[model samples]
Target: MDPLYTTTDDPNDSMENISSNFTDSYNNQFVQPVWQVVVWAIAYCSIVIVSVVGNIVVIWIILAHKRMRTVTNYFLVNLAFAEASMAAFNTVINFVYSVHNEWYFGLGYCRFHNFFPIAAVFASIYSMTAIALDRYMAIIHPLQQRLSSAETKLVIGVIWVLALLLAFPQYFYSTTAELPGRIVCYIDWPEYKIWDFKLTYQICVTVLIYILPLVIMGVAYLVVGLSLWASEIPGDCTDRYREQLTAKRKVVKMMIVVVCTFALCWLPYHVYFLLHMFHPDLLEERFIQQVYLAIMWLAMSSTMYNPMIYCLLNDRFRAGFKQAFYWCPFVPEGSYKSLELKTTRYLQTQISMYRVSRMDTTVSTVLPFGTPDDTTEPAREEEPGCLRHTAVDLSPNGSTRDTHSKTTPPPSPTTTWTSED
Candidate 1:
């Protein structure tokens, strides 16, 4: 058989095999040419619709809401922006490549294709870590100055820097490799280097981005949940029930919605990479590869989910969306409370206010309240006092671990909880 005609699955095939057999194998792998094209096209279009629309709304919600303009939300907005970019720049082009099995965008973009996802995903994962830390601070130490707007901005800045740092290797090593009938892009790592670099990179990044952050977030949320649970009110009067219901249910539910979704979406992608590392034969299996790709895509889809979780799980986000999108009896003269979230009575001294967001600073009127119902399934409220806070605690003086006080009660319910679904 000619070298160019060999199957990728055929161990004996050479890169020189650029003949009819290669075409046959490639076509057979897809099974039906038209169906493969159709499926890819449909998948691409769906991803585009979801990533663009969902992330745009997420950005808008964070941008438009004053309360959401905080440090944590700022990182979230950055994440939303990153995912939107990946969708616009990466997903559509990847679809084209899948359909044609060719790289026409030239060497530069081939490098871009090879490198950008690494950067974007890195930024994305790092942003989540930042958010996780932020929540950890707020939940563990309620009295301390939680993340300031300035600090959040700095953290976001650092995340991008780290992402680029990790991604910089791409600029040095990626290029298109030509074959008789095909061209492919890859990093310059040889077998040993590739395995070493990829393994180290994957392990470290996973620990920082997924494992450690998750472990910390888990603990913080647990403490927060426990705090809220301790504050839950017993049945009897309506007003006390309502007060406790509002405070606890809204906070706890929103936290669960955010953290749980993050965990679930990211798991598949992480596992796929792990499996790929140990099983070269598994990679050769077309169906398995497809499954791996699907999971990676699913994890990428989380960028669009924050808005949904925020709106559906929290009455406050829901009200904010309503205010953002529809009519107001008043000329947008609404309090955050009117949007359903009560502002903290105390300013809660922050350690380093990080010179950002002056009181006079105005936000662009772009966010819709709650989440849009059309994009995903409508969510029902769960048990009362269930809304948990998403924040990380800090030492009162901003010391790494000391000087923090524990005073504010998780604030017990003065009202009854209806456990609305």
Candidate 2:
């Protein structure tokens, strides 16, 4: 007489009574038509294919390229790992079970099917939450020390540990039962006199996996958006500073799109499950099977959208994707190579320029002599027993002119510029 199972043709017969009437062939009353099943199968299969491939590629892009291994990308790796794992392990299985209303995979898989999705979802959203906090720290408090690579890895580990703990109850309570004509897998929560344990657990899972993280990210992004958009650029800000600000804004925008996509995809799923818990009669409606399929498909579709979003909104990710698929017929030759690789001479020149600029600031600030006056005198290069000298002139237009004079050639510079996410 469990609410999960529908009554047999005989309205008065209980599940126990119905089970005795069938031995071999199960009457699947919820079965859809052949065409509807085929369409649903195609939809679900597409989610699996795109999600697994897209997320795996995202993981590879982050982990394979040393240049791509930042704190944000590390969190992205975790997010991709969770999404790919869920899509590969759970999506199609969930489709088959939901559509057929039978559990063919036995008790162990049933437990895993229920348990791992929760854990994966937990890891996925909280990875996003971690990214939001990281972004907030970076933009709102630029001087604060950001998470190092080691610290980021440790945080990812802690996220998984917490996810497993949160999902453990689902695994423990999951069991398979031989109902009227079919074996079914479900969570068998023990009843309590004071409250409905199942409903309470569902509510907790919904909050932890969906509501709470969304709230945190919402607040973080709201502040970040205001700061980035509402503030005016300083009059003296350099082009490099302006470029950096634009880059930060792009990153925040990309993440907001990703977060919104995730929220929209999962909102209906949480609503559906919550309603099912409270109004069990809704499950008995004739159209409910199709409703469940549509909702589940939308939720699972979230797994595939992030890689697409990154490709669209991020230049580096787009370049990485191009690099990954460079073998394609349409990709221009040598395009991918330039995305991450720079010439040694180009890097050296950039480093030298950066050093010379820094040296100019230092020499102007700490020298014993006052600021240099306009003069056509050529400064002499370094001689043994004398300090380096350079000539600087202030033009009428307020630009400082520097003579091409150096006491010593800048040492061969080794640093290279790296683009961040």
Error (Å) of candidate 1 at residue 186 is 2.1
- Alpha carbon lDDT of each predicted model: 0.54, 0.70
Q: Name the runs in model 1 displaced over 4 angstroms.
A: 1-28, 65-67, 191-195, 230-249, 320-421
Give the poorly placed runs of model 2, Cα more than 4 Å off.
1-27, 330-334, 341-421
TM-score of each: 0.67, 0.78
For model 2, residues 48-94, the per-residue Cα lDDT tens digits are: 99999888889887778765666778899999999999999999998
Q: Give the TM-score of candidate 2.
A: 0.78
Across 50-115, the per-residue lDDT of candidate 1 in tens digits comes to: 777767766777666554565555776787788788877777676565445455787788677766
Q: Looking at candidate 1, what is the lDDT of residue 326?
A: 55
lDDT of 2: 0.70
Which one wins on lDDT? 2
